[model samples]
Target: MQRGLSGQYEIGSVVGQEEVRAFVPAPLPPDPLPDLAGERGRLHEQALLACGRLDAITALLPEPDLFLYAYVRKEALVSSQIEGTQSSLSDLLLFELEETPGVPFDDVVEVSNYIAALEHGLGRLREGFPLSNRLLREIHERLLARGRGAERQPGSLRRTQNWIGGTRPGNAHFVPPPPQRVESQMADLERFLHDDQQPFSALIKAALAHVQFETIHPFLDGNGRMGRLLIALILHEDRVLHQPLLYLSLYFKQNREEYYRLLDATRREGDWEAWLDFFLEGVLTTANGAVETAHRLLDVFREDREQVEGTGRSAANALRVFHALGTRPVASINDLAERSGVAYPTASRAVEALEGLGILREITGRRRDRVFAYWRYIAVLNEGAEPL
Candidate 1:
């Protein structure tokens, strides 16, 4: 049966709020992570295999697909992040496009806008910008660049209280420390980012940061998604992984329940090892998945290039034509015109050229309106994954 999410606004399916402030959550407990999480032997073996496999394939690949991987993953993370009172795992996938029956859609366009900004921020990070609250605030602010919440540009720090879960007005599943507590939370967060006090490995540190930040719930919105992206950022910053091609969302989405449970458990039990192991497992799984995606993408690129080039296009034009692979993976003829910055006739000629050579596959049979797909590459992106 389909989910009955007929309501129009997002609220915690599990967490509740008493009007955002004056919220009270469950009792907090000490750390509960085991030193090795008992499942160590098998998990260790899997980790070794995962690391070796990912590194081997990644060694052959060059840059991150800034257009495909980073951008799409950012979109998923950001949508899942703030979604304020209503966001859910399933909602992340549809937030920007086709409204689903029984599911609410609001500020959809804004999600894309912020995702673009997220891409911009990631670009800056790769360029060596220092990470700071000001930087993050800027990203959140731009997230409102379009859509319903555009006026919510003051996406700045929260001055009021926010809660994670519950139904009663004053009760929440989780609540951040407080407005005054932001600074201390920031300090801890910053130190974790830059400090050498590796109470554990890079994998473990990543988990610790995630749990701590969620515990802090720094912003009134976007905390969950931002926290997830921050994981990839940390890995890249620390050189734990190359090229942020990871789709940690895939793992978390599959293990959604445990993901939240362990996050909550960290606060209740201080089970650092449990969370660390979980995070590592996610890393191992996603890293391997990403490698497969990369190879699949490369194959599609090569094949698409062949088809476009067979039309006798210049080598340089071949580069531009191959762009159809990622630029607008789903392009209408109009999209083709806008993207290539060409007149309708010129765009038509180009599409016909590729189509004749079997590069761009038409999706719709309609004459008046049509859509074309760079199926090979898109298939790779959409492979093994449903919407977030």
Candidate 2:
């Protein structure tokens, strides 16, 4: 369906130096999202089913927030990694503990900024804020607040031309709409988002919104990470999921080439169908993986608890510490003492008991200020979060 130039290109000056053609993406909710019949229909059903399974897992958890907190951090790491950050899940956990050690400060800050940005977006949504350009700017501000790209206009749209890949717009893989047209393009997008007359599924809308946002390249920095975050945010806002759980960063990180190619194809060939198929498949895969990870985490917690129970009198204190570990996954004895509301010695004893049961592993091996990890629990969550 090669509809030709997805949007009009405007002749613009590059830093007032030379003329360049900047691509302005047409506003979204795309007139018609290729028809949702036959194979596409089946993919949609599978995606919905997978989402159902994911939501059900949240219901099964006694304290889904404990899982949600850790899960969101994992997403933050993966999403940031897609933008070339080297922070790992363990680094994020350790960073949150105020322990830097071998972690790169800049990378960890970027990851932390991601967490803050996501939390900000979710908080605003909970307060009944519409997912508009305003919220996007708010999130973008937090994202670049204290990281490497902080100087590149944190919350504002780019005033000068920005290009993706290569050295400059002339040799770049893609050049987004010039700065002057960004506001109007974004306003059109906001209308499409609020337009109820548009006939499109929430999932389809999210997929299209993501690509459109990326194409717009609205911000000077953090557009890629923000575009990816928009997927989960849109779904959460649309009530497609009770919690912001589905993350496709790992899938995108794994299929990096194809992911970029599909986006390019969509812009160059109007091959929305192919992109939609890939997006739905990512939804299906990511949702199912999240469900399985939830189950495995629960199993680890249950099995560890049962082992702790076998320790008799020490079981009660150890169980408390174990529960604390379930929330943080990694902690020092002092942290356990604070989180479990136990004395330092008691927390140490409980940690020792759990360690004896092979439920916790001491990571530092230092007698003083030792840190322990709920190895199995962390392993389950760290499955796809390894540095890419």
Model number with the top lDDT: 2
Instruction: Give residue 64's lDDT in candidate 2 (0 to 100).
Output: 96
The TM-score obtained by model 2 is 0.96
Give lDDT tens digits, candidate 2, residues 1-388. 1124466677777654567777777677554458789999999999999998897788889879888998899899998888888877878888888655766899999999998999999999999999999999999999999869999899998888898998777878988888888888888878877788877878988898888889989998999999988988888998888899999999999999999999998887778899999999999999988888888888888888888888888889998999998889888999999999999999999988888888889876577777888888888899889987
TM-score of each: 0.72, 0.96
lDDT of 2: 0.87
Q: Rate the local accuracy (lDDT) of all candidates.
A: 0.58, 0.87
For model 2, the stretches where C-alpha displacement exceeds 4 angstroms are 1-3, 15-17, 31-33
lDDT by residue for model 1 over 31-149, one digit each (tens)? 33346545764674576467556656656754345234533644354344434323432343334323433444553444455466667667778889866666667776666555555
